[model samples]
Target: MAKPQDLPLELLQFYLTAPYPCSYLDNEEARSQVLAPNSPINSHIYSELVRHGFRRSGSFTYRPHCDQCQACVPVRVNVEEFIWRRINRRIFKKNQDLTVHHQRLVFKEEHFQLYLAYQQARHPKGDTDTDSKEQYVHFLIHSPVNSELIEFRLNNQIVMVSVIDYLDDGISSVYTFFDPTQPDRSLGQFNILWQLNLCRTLTLPWLYLGYWIKECRKMNYKIQFQPLEGLIDHQWQPLAFAQE
Candidate 1:
């Protein structure tokens, strides 16, 4: 077992071969990845890896690295410049009744039940299938650095949750789930908007939003946040509606 301190900053090099068809695209193939070991410089390494478009999972950090597909674009919102559009404002007002609480990651029965409900309602066919307590800990509680669970409540009842990883430069939205029964509230959209606001309040400039795959409809919503940047050729490029 590798201790947290044993983890490396720079990924040496890793490889993977897909089992079959890819999830993002129908005709595309999926690939695997591995990383090399550097030093256990958590904060510095995380910042560098993110700027380079890699996402963290457990002790390993990886990028798309898929040869057949370059659709997974890394996205980050410009906190200082983000402007809430009409729809976003509506969502903010809609969810105004909910109260948010932030705390360190800890497994609770209520959270597990909510997570299970969210998985079954939103991603029934997802890999985990059922959101068990052990699975919840593995997925949400397991972290190498500072992490927190942001829970939203309504009338003292838990309704939504977001797993966040804190780094020196920004906050990475590891995962988020909500009571799917409230479709009118658009919890997913609200969660992102809330996170952006939280980042602004904390003076964090970037809010890492995982990947934005143009071919994946589920991921298209990420682009709605204007004044965002995407990683292209190892550089952060501004997203523009009309480009030369």
Candidate 2:
């Protein structure tokens, strides 16, 4: 087998990670086709890679390389034509009191605490040690590409924090965590909408929402935002769905 480094520098090289337990599926293993970290994969390279169905975690870029599954679909919102339905509008209204700020990456104790609470509440069975500040900083704060720590505060209380990457074309949502106790506010959905609004303000064409798994209930939210573009068979296509 050829190592990623052996490939010519003019072209991006990828390495396959050994399969592990699949996080999104039960009784399955998942492998990743990772872009070797040694290359000069800056925001420009990452932006192009995402168009080819790649995504970043920390400084590494990767896509699903599972042998028997193609369930992980890379998706992005058509921010230019994104429509806010009645319920979506209500969600925006529900979060009216929250003030949003787009700032450079910084790890805050408040954000870490909320993230811990969110992980415990939302993913109790997961193996990750979300309580570690080191992992949090490594995941959300450290990045080779241009990124931001978007804060959503309600009544001056830190309710939500979203880490997103900036591409020349649009923004890619890296991760988001909120006060899981306040389920009524729908912080998860609002975060995307907020980014879409930001995309419009910047005149960007898309807002990459990361991987969307049709069989995963938690991931179903990505498709709810209409006119979703999914990378299928190495090409981007519109997912067929009726507007509600």
Candidate 3:
């Protein structure tokens, strides 16, 4: 396996995207430093990129590079040190009947339908809610690295799906969508708990959770999981605010 320092210099080259509308913040523009499209991205290279605060969207690997704003902070869970609060334990117990299946990155109609429903219910009229089949396929099914699709089924019915990347050091939670109507099920929280357990079972120490924005209500749930470390100033440190 190639180490981070052993990666070819060409792979380090990046393309800065033109400022686009910020997804998390209103009326603000955002830019990304994206890896060159031609560069070969395998598991090891992507693992190195994640360690440097980058995230994968489909086959694209990029990180926030706003010219003046630095609101986006990469975060990961110290799975080995994760604390299970009362709510977390309750969520785990509630989801005990759900069966888990690990799958490859193949296109499945049922998964797409569930994703569409989730987007419409949770993010109605948002960017992904109106996605066509091709767009949905391009968004989640086109990974070039080691990725897995975890399906959560209840009574043999698909209830949720999580896309995860297997990093050299840990697992990266790419994306998760669940049956929005089942709020009581707390499938999202259960999925994270399951990933944390998986990390322990695999003896991995971290669970990369992409980026966290303090002001984004959609992201507020991330900090609730204890022992989260954020990438700040190129260093991973325990988020002081999260400690509270």
- Name the top lDDT candidate: 3
Number of backbone collisions per candidate: 4, 0, 0
Off by over 4 Å in 3: 1-5, 8-11, 127-130
What range of 10 consecutive residues in model 2 has the weakest lDDT sum? 1-10
TM for every model, in the order presented, reads 0.86, 0.93, 0.95
The most accurate candidate by TM-score is 3
- What ranking emerges by lDDT with the best candidate at the front? 3, 2, 1
| Alpha carbon deviation, residue 128, candidate 1 (Å) | 5.3
lDDT of 3 by residue, 1-244 (tens): 6555478645477999999999999989999999988776789888888999999899899999998899999999999789989999999999999999999988889998999899889878787544788888877899989999999999999999999999999999999999998999989889999999999999999999999998898999899888999999999999989754
**Error of model 2, residue 6, in angstroms:** 20
Compare candidates 2 and 3 on TM-score and give the better one: 3
Clashing pairs in 2: none
- Over 103-149, each residue of candidate 1 has an lDDT whose tens digit, in order, gives 89888888888888888886778777445677678778876667789
Q: After the best TM-score superposition of candidate 1, give how far the Cα of residue 162 lies from its true spot, in angstroms.
A: 0.2
lDDT of each: 0.79, 0.86, 0.91
In terms of TM-score, how similar is model 3 to the real structure? 0.95
Clashes of 2: 0
